[model samples]
Target: MAVLSKQVAVPKSGFSPIPVIDMSDPESKHALVKACEDFGFFKVINHGISAELVSVLEHETVEFFSLPKSEKTLVAGYPFGYGNSKIGRNGDVGWVEYLLMNANLDSGSGPLFPSLLKSPGTFRNALEEYTISVRKMTCDVLEMIIDGLGIKPRNTLSKLVSDQNTDSILRLNHYPPCPLINKKTNCGKNVIGFGEHTDPQIISVLRSNNTSGLQINLTDGSWVSVPPDHSSFFFNVGDSLQVRLIS
Candidate 1:
């Protein structure tokens, strides 16, 4: 009988520091390069998305999600996709509502992506700001990644990405408490936050702390913990980025 494979890596405390790089330091660049190579993931503290902005985004996310299920379902076009997407057991959605926004570099108006984005101020303003700020951070991070890869500093991380030069999207998600104490994959227990799958996004800039729902699959048949850090965004190259890099 074939069974699904699942393993979760709970983080061990020892780690390289969550970096806040100074572009001015020659050595700063080198350290960043090493961090990426050693672990495809790292936390960026002092990354400067103002507290006010963060607060705005957080407040709005809650306000938006709390609306009537019908209101949320208004923009629900994609599968389970109002403004939210249900990640495959491998995608990230099991029992969670998340924001899926695009910073359309190809499309002129950011609102060109969908109707939901333009609806009202609560979801509109914060998402717009979040999309912009996040993309800026993503663009800077990609350049650093290029440098770390020893490529020309101006190398295009994703060619034909867009005229805007970069397009960043957002996936804001929420995982309600799971009612499982001794939760193991299929070990006869009722526990779930999400199924299991690797992230397919190029970069992940999440805003979360301590609820501990996200996990990554390692090649060794184990799931690793995505350490929750509210202040810093977590970055990991997606399947798209990996494919581009490998090719």
Candidate 2:
């Protein structure tokens, strides 16, 4: 586990540089494309997802993570289910654990959790509802982006994700709070949480608790910490989208 000086943490300020887009507004498509071109990341508001649904899933997630380590391990599997510390096979480690699920399990991918989950049925239901809503929002955003780009057939980008065979994934990440360091040095250290990396998919939609550690690299190569907003989802253009656009 690599540690970095606390100085690396940027303090939250009154103003934020991250672009905010209102998804309900048709004119926002222009801003959406501009944000993608400029920052490749932006916050979305009026996304049409229910707050009640979000809360239900979050509550279920908390209960799931609170399970005994032994019980939680029941769902453990490579590339899916429960993962702790180590992320991917690249040997990159972080102070985080996550639950990864295939977005579309209906195409005969089989059940994701074989025998775990204290309330398996309830958990699965929550997952299904949340996934359906978010996936729709993702397609909507994609179509808007395509419209702004003046591309033929706005569904060009949206259809890829909307397909039943789409390999989209839903990941729920949990970052436990790490204890503060020695009072003597006064320069506290922090653990690396999901060490710096970019999403390789078409796009990534993320939401987190009030705790704020998410940061994005700018076009100029400087890192800027994003303020946490539990009510809104954050979207980032992935490498696949960039490749698609360029091609």
Q: Against the true structure, whose TM-score is highest?
A: 2
Q: What are the C-alpha RMSDs, in order, of all predicted structures?
A: 6.1, 5.0
The top-ranked prediction according to lDDT is 2
lDDT of 2 by residue, 125-148 (tens): 888899899999999999999999
Task: Compute the lDDT for candidate 1.
Answer: 0.54
Residue pairs clashing, model 1: 7-223, 8-223, 9-223, 9-224, 9-225, 87-93, 88-91, 89-196, 90-196, 90-197
Worst 10 residues of 1 by lDDT: 1-10
Note the Cα lDDT for every prediction shown.
Answer: 0.54, 0.78
Candidate 2's error at 225, in angstroms?
1.0
Model 2 TM-score is 0.87
How accurate locally is residue 31 in candidate 2, as Cα lDDT from 0 to 100? 90
After superposing candidate 1, which stretches have Cα over 4 Å from the reference? 1-26, 79-93, 105-119, 153-155, 158-162, 165-167, 177-190, 243-247
lDDT of 1 by residue, 70-185 (tens): 77666554432444435534354466665554565234423322343334565566666766676666666677777767787454763323246444555556665444443465
